[model samples]
Target chain A: MNLNATLLGELIAFVVFVLFCMKYVWPPLNGAIEARQKKIEDGLAASDEAEKELERVRKEAAVELNEAKSQAAEIIEQAKKRAALIVDEETTRGQQEREKIIAQGHSEIDSERNRVKEELRTQVATLAVVGAEKILEREINQDAHSDIVDKLVAEL
Target chain B: MAAEEVTLSSHIQHHLTNAKMCSTDAGLAFNKACADSGFWTWHVDTLAWSIGLGLLFLWIFRSAAKKSTTGVPGKFQCFIEMIVEFVGDNVRDTYHGKSALIAPLALTIFVWVFLMNLMDLIPVDFLPAFAGFVGETAFGMDSHDVYMKIVPTTDINMTAALALGVFFLMIGYSIKMKGIGGFIAELTLHPFSTKNKIGMIFLIPFNLLLETIALVAKPFSLALRLFGNLYAGELIFILIGAVGLMQLPLHFIWAAFHILVIVLQAFVFMMLTIVYLSMASSDNH
Candidate 1:
């Protein structure tokens, strides 16, 4: 075959094709590959961040649970102390009340005995005066005997 | 038997010949001065098919590039991507330069040469016969004068053209990367440089002679290697075609073997181009 215009034609065609490919084809393809790679990288980073956040949340929850447990125990201890103090206070008040009631009863009994004794003494004096009057058969000095009776009442 | 043998040899010769078009005093003439290697003579069939296939390659790749995605690729896109990746891999492995042109150049050479070489798989008489019919009907020319050789790589012109393109790139890259002085020094001082100044001076002409021959031989070998393989393969097809009915099975067998040769040759051409360009660009000469 003659090495004529065909060689030149092929050369020109090759050069043009190479230029076209360089200009139009390679960039977008490479861009797509790079973008997919970046997407995968970002996804991996996000997953790592999510995992860290989960760990932080878990630790925070555990700490909060421990604090709540200790506070509950403190509240229970305080409640028990308050209940014991209330019971002790109630016991002392009840003892005081019983003592006061007993004292009042003793005082009332003494007063009653004294009143009975006074009544008995007055009755005896009246009996004695009647017997003496019958024996003497006369009213012997009533004004002078009244003074003795008054003295006897004062002694009783 | 002698007549059959004569016809067989002529048949092979006929298939090997190109459909040449020469501008005559009267205008475009078919197969005029078919043996002549004049400036006006064009290998019509070779140019037509080669350019047609080159355009097809461009159209397919360009369209695929246009419709390409970051998401899942379609079947056509996948196929195009596979080819691009295959060629890009070779370019990456062999080409050391940072130029954006080399990879695409390698890709074009690989695919374009492959498409040209694949023409050999067509039955010997198929396209020529078709062209002959069309020529007779449309152009009012005799079918006998419409000589057409379908495979472009079988033509020395096409292969030499590709190889020469690589040769120019090799020189261009060498000059661009190493500077003119460094390139000259490399050519004149390589493969036989000595520590002794006087002795090295004596070695300059020897080195230049050998290195220049080596430089020219790169393209020469690249062209001849492809041309020889395809020409031989096409000749075999022509021989098989002359066997009439038995040619079918033989065609199948030869086609299978030629497929390997075709792909291998394309790969070799592309790899050599990349290697040559890399060597030109690298500082180690």
Candidate 2:
């Protein structure tokens, strides 16, 4: 083989092939690879963010649940306290009402007894006059009798 | 039988020679009929096959480029991608430079040289015989004079050319990175450096000689290594071809082993190119 011509030809071929490769082949393939890499990275990042957000939401839900539980406990505790207060107030009111009614009854009984006693004293005085008249059958000292009768009334 | 033996040996010899074309006193003639000698002749067969293979390599790659996608890749696309990625990875690992040219150059060298060397796998006698038959039957030319060889890498000139291209790039990158002065100084001052003036004066020439030999040997070794391997592989195939029907098993065995040789040579050529280029562009010196 003629060394010069073959060398020239091979050199030319190598340059042409290399130029074509740089222009056409390498860039597009490399671009595809880099794009795929970026896509994977972004996807991974998005998944991580989703996981973090999920964790945060779970924590918030737990906190809300705890708050709700405490609020419910507080409401129940207040309801129990209010119920006891209402019961005490009602019992005290009932006791006061019963005492007021009992006092009224005692006053009424005292007044009525006084009235009867007055009536009974009148009758007893009348009956005592009749008995004195029968025992003495004649005219007695009326001033003296009145004096007895006034003493008797004063005793009664 | 003796005449047939003579014809057979001559056939082998004719197949071995390049299909040389040159300007003669009479006119342009093919092979030994040409009057021109030395550098005037051209190996038309080597040029034709190597350039044709180079173009084929381009066509295959560019077609893949057009069809390439970021999504699911087809078989052809996948094959092309594998080759490109293989070369790119080697370049990324071995070549420390940031030049845009390195990866593509490595890819081209690997694929183009491989295609050239792959020609060795073709039966040596098949192509030339076919050409001879065509020449005799169609063109009514002398079949003996229609020389043809398909394996371009087997030709020393082609390997030398490829190596020299790398060598020139090495020089360019070296000068570009180190400056002409630094490059010259490196050529004179490496692998042996003395601070003293007297010591430097004594050492420069010896260092220059050694370093020059080393630099020249880079391309020399690169070219000769590939040429020697492929040439020996082709020679073994030619020798086996002389054995007639007995050549089948031997040819198969040698070809199977030679497949390793072919790939290894192409890989070695590309790797050396990357190393040489990286060295040229690096600053360790």
Candidate 3:
């Protein structure tokens, strides 16, 4: 077929088509695609940031937990030490109290025994004097009376 | 005429010809088929067909463009939008940097070529035979001279035109993207020689010749590829239809098969256009 007209027609048509499509078709389509791509990239970036945040929080929590655990251990150790010191102090105080009580009891017993012995000796002397006075009145001589008293006292 | 006892070839022509002979226009060779009256007649030529098809597609796309939604698209909108997106994505993948023209140009090439290619799907005899009838009835010209080819891409002129347009675009874009000096430098120094002056001198002439051949070959390849596919398709359809009444079923089957060819050819043309544009736009050898 003679294609001179056809060729010219096709060229004109292609030029018109290229112009028309450039004006109307490409913008929206490319916009939509680029928008979708950007959205995906943003979503991925957000996810990465969230993951990093999560990691940071986990580390912080671990540190806090470790600090809390160490503090509790230290408190427990302090409590144990305090408890041992209190027990030792209480034991020493109890022993001192026991010794003071024993010393006071011994002192009281010694004082009571000394007082009783002194009282018994005084009573014996008084009884002998009374018996000698009664016997000397009956007998009327000084030398005889003295000798009788001494013998009576000795016999008692 | 002396009958020199000629021996007939043993092979017999098939019975299908008898059926076709029955449908032959008895007076077609002798008949002075006329052209039709009215605007439709002028529009019957290749140029008119191209313009008309372009306008029809534009109208359809305009309507689709008007109904384009911000929300979820309807089925038709989605279909149209898919084509648009596909074209855009293809441009992005193939053509790098900011080619404001190439992407849309590629889109136009794709749609126009596709529509032109679709003309092959119309029955071979439908338009021309109808035009012949109309010519005889209306314009009072010979129907034989009406000679309207509906499938524009099948025509060498149409394919070459398209190729030439692309060729011009390639040149224009190259010049616009790469300055005249840069363009010349590239042609001279490319595909060899980075630093050495000797290497540059040796490679420049060879590269220049290769580049020149490549530039010429681009349009040729584009034109021939589309023309070859479409013309072959048109030929096959004509051949199938020539088998006449007995082969109606076979013709129908071949027509169905031809639909695949039509779409495939369109796609191939579109892909090649993208590739060529990409090549033209690039700095790489």
Tell me the whole-model lDDT of each prediction, alpha carbons only: 0.83, 0.86, 0.69
- Candidate with best lDDT: 2
For A5-89, candidate 3 gives per-residue lDDT tens digits of 3455567777887778677766665565466667778989999999999999999999999999999999999999999999999
Per-residue lDDT tens digits of candidate 2, residues B21-57? Answer: 8777778877877535667777888999998988899
TM-score, cand. 3 vs. native: 0.61
Report DockQ per prediction, comma-separated. 0.38, 0.40, 0.20
* Best candidate, DockQ: 2
For candidate 3, list the clashing residue pairs, or say none: B33-B141, B33-B142, B33-B143, B34-B135, B34-B141, B35-B141
DockQ ranking, best first: 2, 1, 3
Error of 1 at B205 (Å): 1.4
Tell me the tens digit of each residue's lDDT in model 3 across B1-285.
012331222101110001000112442131112121211112235566777878777766666777665555688877877777777778778777776887777667777778888888787778776875687679885554445567777767778888899888788777777888777886787666668888888888988997788888988888898889888877777666566595588777877887888777767777777787777667776
- lDDT by residue (B111-136, candidate 1, tens digit) is 88999998888888888888878888
Candidate 3 wrong stretches, greater than 4 Å: A1-5, A28-156, B1-44, B191-205
Q: Is candidate 1 or candidate 2 better by lDDT?
A: 2
Candidate 2 lDDT, A21-67, residue by residue in tens? 89988898777766766888898999999999999999999999999
TM-scores for every candidate against the unseen true structure? 0.75, 0.75, 0.61
CAPRI verdict (incorrect, acceptable, medium, high) for model 2: acceptable
